[model samples]
Target: MATKTKITIQDIAEKLNITASTVSRALNNNPRISEETRKAVLKAAKQLNYQPNNIAAALRNGKSHIIGVIVPTADRTFFASVVRGIEEIANKLNYKVIICQTYDSYEKEVQTIDALLSARVDGIIASIGKNTENFSHYKKVLASGLPLVLFDRTTDQLDVSQVGINDYLASYKIVEHLIKEGCTRIAHFTSPKKISIFRERLRGYTDALQDNGIPFDENLVISSNLQLEGGRQSMEKLFEAGELPDAIFSASDYGAMGAMQVLKERGVAIPDRVALAGFSNEPFTSFTDPPLTTVDQLSLTMGNITAELFFEQFKLKDKKFVPQRTVLMPEIIIRKSSLKKG
Candidate 1:
């Protein structure tokens, strides 16, 4: 077995017959060092397989070159797309991403954020969990001088950079579309309004009905956990009430799919007896028995934008980086489920 030799800055300097200070400056891309010297130093470092100690480098630069990303769940397609986007941008900029899944638990979320802070990440991008009621953990991250960006799920209490679609407008548009297609009594299936995204969507649903002169009935609005079982049970409850809605707008595609399955089992003709619409534009939407009408939230785009926002702050340390909240417009996809049979 051959022993591997440790290569360091001093070794590179000694081989090149240059001072360590010059090699260090060249490696750091200091303006004082000429471009030629910088290139030569990098080439030599590469040849020697020199691996700079990231911890030491971070200590010197006052940045860890790592961004912490906290999301509700990693198993979901929407969140996976967002992670892909963040990874793409982070890789291009020579930054690393540390992902933590909160599993929709408030305690886990707090613990995860604390762990990330202890790890000395330069910035954070988070889509909070369902049960997150306190903003104190987030406030600590802000207080630590770390740049934070919230995406998809966020709180109004935190004044930070946000990248997401307009949930309210998306919901309103879907409901309006259903109404235009002759759906009078529309039922809304959603999770608890504790999260801003759900609340916004619920508001949009109510506002659209009011604008179109349809009376808002509390019974017509069904609250679920935005899960498959929840959707299944909610649909059953609505049907048992004997006032089946002319249409249904679900906040989650899975929920919509669940409801659709039950309706199909009961021999209800879609878009004739009831039309169905959902949010998130998940891939399953296209393959559903009668493809689903859904709102495209551009999950990947939101993720990419969040990474870009982090790099923007990374490059320009002293630049006035104002907290920006960007809301993408959702696009409605017309499909067989919501298309009326003439």
Candidate 2:
């Protein structure tokens, strides 16, 4: 069996009795080419099954027309929704997106950035991994002259475009709501303070307590990875103190769910014995026993805005650009987890 010869612009040109350059211009939709010639060239190219050399074209134009999107993990609904929002805009603009997950590992985040850079992507939009402490990898992106947009998880050390909710305000609102529910001695489950989101949430929690005349107790603040297991460990540690908190506010929904499981195992009544609230409003929050109260980070909107920011920067390439930070207002979703009925 003989393999078929790969069809090319030359073959299409030969079949249509037109110049190869004309065929190329037609395929590219160059305005200079007449519509009749462009249509005929396209029809012939399709009939011949011509495959254009995209790599060579990218080399000539100095653009891959591709963008990289980095997220900690896509398994969660929040990140997945954000990616959907990004793809909606990116696809319309004729740009392909490459999704990379770091799984909250600093080393993996660094390597992912390096890989994206090597791929020659036109730009990148990312949510910094929770474990990342160094901004050098992100700075390298700027030095290389590619646009970088950070969403949800961001750092101030690097001056680049960023889009996310006002985490401090969101935290304060939720904590205040818990307070209004008559929850005193509210405990907090948080992650490392190095990351801006966690840090801001912590600050909001502390400030809310002070404003409400509740004494700030260091013992009530538990620091951990904020994963499900971490939440369980943190709750167990609180139990060791021989005093139970009237309420629990977790920086992440996963952590809150973990704490909820531990409480249920101990026969503790939710919202009656101890109210609970969480952030990011992960989809499972609604389906949990006595649905949880959480903050809506507007993941899809954040993703759309992040992609738009990247495109804005891409268009202004080579221009002196000032970094733009977009902060969206977060909604506090009230549910049975935090509402105590008489």
Candidate 3:
């Protein structure tokens, strides 16, 4: 279908019995326009469905006034909330946001960056894909002199602004909580250790076990993609060792949900025969039959800070601002899955 013609200032002016120039000036909030005329023009513009031409305005200012946001997926609550936070800040600053999902593919992440660059976005906020070992695509953003900010999943190889929770400390707290619950044999469902975030989490898990005087059993750990199916498969692999873990700490809520499904099928009662906990505090965690215990990584706040970092660069202009890394602490949410409740 063809697009409908957009209503313009002239269309609104015609409806308001005024000149197009007067309507334009009023819409732009020029001081020359009387308050009464401004109100009338705005009301008429709303009635006529007139939309401002941001592209024309951006051309005049030599800035797109649009921020490019890249994430693994919007299907997850954590990423969606981050987008929400970006939009909130973008709106307040009169900047628009365009989001791109890489779906956890390195190739697709490259494509998204190219597309955003083609669109001439003022800056970019990104959470890298799991498979992204190469950093050239991100380096290109710096080469172009565009401010780039990373969030959640980032790398040490590239020096860029980033915001995320302290995954190592968060994982340590998770394992410690399970130990306090009398769970000695604790299994872990984790992503590949190649990624810096996962590496920190895995490190925390092993350190926590060692600190608590529990032997670090590699057989009890399974690599997961942080997907629901991956969780189920990890559970099976953990049980194949001829020793069942009394508790499980999954790197993601989706993985924990998958473990729950498999356990329920095998007639295993949660927090009784086995306890469970997950990361990221996904929305569905609380809705499960037994609410899942999780660590809240402050996704929304991370996004807000990520966008603010981009604006901060604009303010500095000339002075060098060293690559900033903001790591927020994770908030542990206690629920039925991690606790033995009556």
Off by over 4 Å in 1: 1-57, 316-320
CA lDDT of each prediction against the hidden true structure: 0.89, 0.92, 0.88
TM-score of 3: 0.85
lDDT of 2 by residue, 105-146 (tens): 999999999998887888889999988888899999999999
Q: Is candidate 1 or 3 superior in lDDT?
A: 1
Best by lDDT: 2
Q: In model 2, state the lDDT of residue 196.
A: 93
Best candidate, TM-score = 2
Q: RMSD of model 2, in Å?
A: 2.9
Tens-digit lDDT string for candidate 1 (249-284): 999998898899899999998878989998888999
Work out the TM-score per prediction. 0.84, 0.88, 0.85
lDDT of 3: 0.88
Model 3 pairs in collision? none
Question: What TM-score does prediction 1 earn?
Answer: 0.84
Q: How many steric overlaps are in each model, in order?
A: 0, 0, 0
Regarding lDDT, does 1 or 2 come out ahead? 2
